[model samples]
Target chain A: MIGFISEKLTGYLLKRETICQEEYEIYLFGMAQFFRKILVDATVVFLGILFGKAWEMIIFLIAFRVIRIYAGGYHAVTPFGCYLLTILMLFMVLLSLHFISWNLSILTAVWIFASVLILALAPIEVENRPIEEAERIYYKRKVRVFWILENIAILLCMVLHLRMGAESIVLAQATLGMALLCEKWIHGDVRND
Target chain B: MRKGVVKMVLKKVAYHEAEKSAKIICGWFFYQPKLPNAVKKLRKF
Candidate 1:
C-alpha cells in the first residue's frame, strides 16, 4: 500500500520533471517514510484517545525517542515489521500504564534501574550496522545528556506531585531498558554462533 | 523570481526529508541527528 502510493507519487514527479530518474529511489524512499511515519503516529494518537491516555502517550513518546535514538535497539527486518512492532510496543506500554498502580517510590526505583541498564549497555551494535569508535563515543556522550535531562524532568514532576507524569517517563525508561537487553541477548547469540 | 525562490525552498525540504528518511531506514523510526559525514562515508565504504 505504502509502496503503491510512493510509486504513484514518483510517477507523478517524473511526469512533472521535478525529480529525474536518477533521483527516483531517494524520493520514493522518502515519501514512503513520510507516509509510514504519519500512519504510525496517527494510529498511536487514535489508540491514545481510545484509551484516554493521550497526554501520557505523548510523554512516553518523547522520553522513549530521546533515549532510543542514541541507545539503538531491536530493529525489525522490514518496514512493515517495524510498524507492527511499534504498534505492539505502544499497546503494551499503554496497557501497562492503565493497569499499573504506580507509586512514587516504585517509579523512582524503576527509573534508577533502567538508567543503569541503558548507561551500561546502550549503543549496542548489531552485526549488520556496527558502530565505529568515533560514532560510539559521540553517541555515548549524546545519550547521557538526554538521560540526565529525563531524570531532571522526572524529579520536577515528583516535586510537583505529578505522579502520572513521572510514571509515564519511568515506563518509557523501562521499555528502553528491556529493548536494549533483548537486543544485547540477540547480539550475543549471533556472536556465539 | 518567486518561482526560483519556491523551487529552492522545495529543494531544501526535499533534501532534508531524504536525509531523515535515509536515517530512519538505516536505524529505527525516531528522531536522530544525522551522523557525522565522515562516519557516514566510512560506513558506506
Candidate 2:
C-alpha cells in the first residue's frame, strides 16, 4: 500500500506541470528529507557494525535499497554532486580515524552522522526555471563537482587500501556502483541527463 | 485557445533548440551563449 502511494506520488511529481513552479522551501525541505534518510541509514549501518549485530546490517541494506528506489523514482533526487561530497567526506573521516587510537571508528561514525546533518541543513538554492540553458549549466557544474569528488574519494580509498591492505576500497566501489546503478535506473539512462 | 497554448509551447521549444544550437557553436570558439538574452528573446516571441 505504501509502495503504491509512493509510486503514484513519484509519477505526479515527475509530471511537467507539477515541477514548473517549485518554491525554494520545497527544494530545501526535499533536500533535508533526503539527507535525513541517508543519515538514518548510515547510522544503522555503523551501529550494526559496532555491535556485531547481523540484524542491523540487514536493516541498513534494506534502508539503502529503499533510498535507491526513491532516488530513481523521483526526479528531484539528491544531487550527484552532494552525494559525491558526502562520500568523500566519509572516506576522509575513515582514513583519519585509522591514525587515532581512541575508538576512532566511533569518531568516524559520528563524523559521518554530523556531515549528514550539515548537508541536510545546508542552505542551497535551486533555480526551478523552465529554461533549458540554466538547467544545463547547473547540471554541468554539478556533474563536474561530482566528478572531482568521486575521483578524489576513489583515489584516497585506493591509497588507504594499499597502505593497510583493507577491503574498504572494494566496499567503496560497491557503494559507488550501487549509487550509479540506482541513479541510472531512476533517470532511464546514466550518461549525464 | 488550448491549441494556441500548444503553439506557444512549441514556439518556446523551438526557441530553446535554436538557443542550444547557438550555444554549441559558441562553445567551439570557447564562448557561452548569453542565456538570459536567449530567454528574453524567447519571452518576446
List of clashing residue pairs for candidate 2: A72-A186
In model 1, pairs of residues that clash are none
| lDDT for A57 (candidate 1) | 85
Candidate 1 structure quality by residue, lDDT tens digits, A93-190:
88889887787677768888899888998776554455666767766787899999999998899899987788889989898888878877765523
Top-scoring candidate (TM-score): 1
Runs off by more than 4 Å, candidate 2: A1-35, A38-42, A45-48, A51-133, A160-173, A182-193, B1-45
Docking class of 1: incorrect
Every candidate's DockQ is: 0.19, 0.03
lDDT of 2 by residue, A65-170 (tens): 3222212211232334344444443444354434544243643453354334322321111222223445345444543454345335435644664322122322
lDDT of each: 0.70, 0.35
| Deviation of model 1 at A95, angstroms | 1.9
Q: What is the fnat value (0 to 1) for candidate 2?
A: 0.00
- The number of the candidate with the highest DockQ is 1
DockQ of 2: 0.03
Q: Which ten residues in a row have the lowest lDDT in candidate 2 chain B?
A: B24-33
Worst 10 residues of 1 chain A by lDDT: A184-193
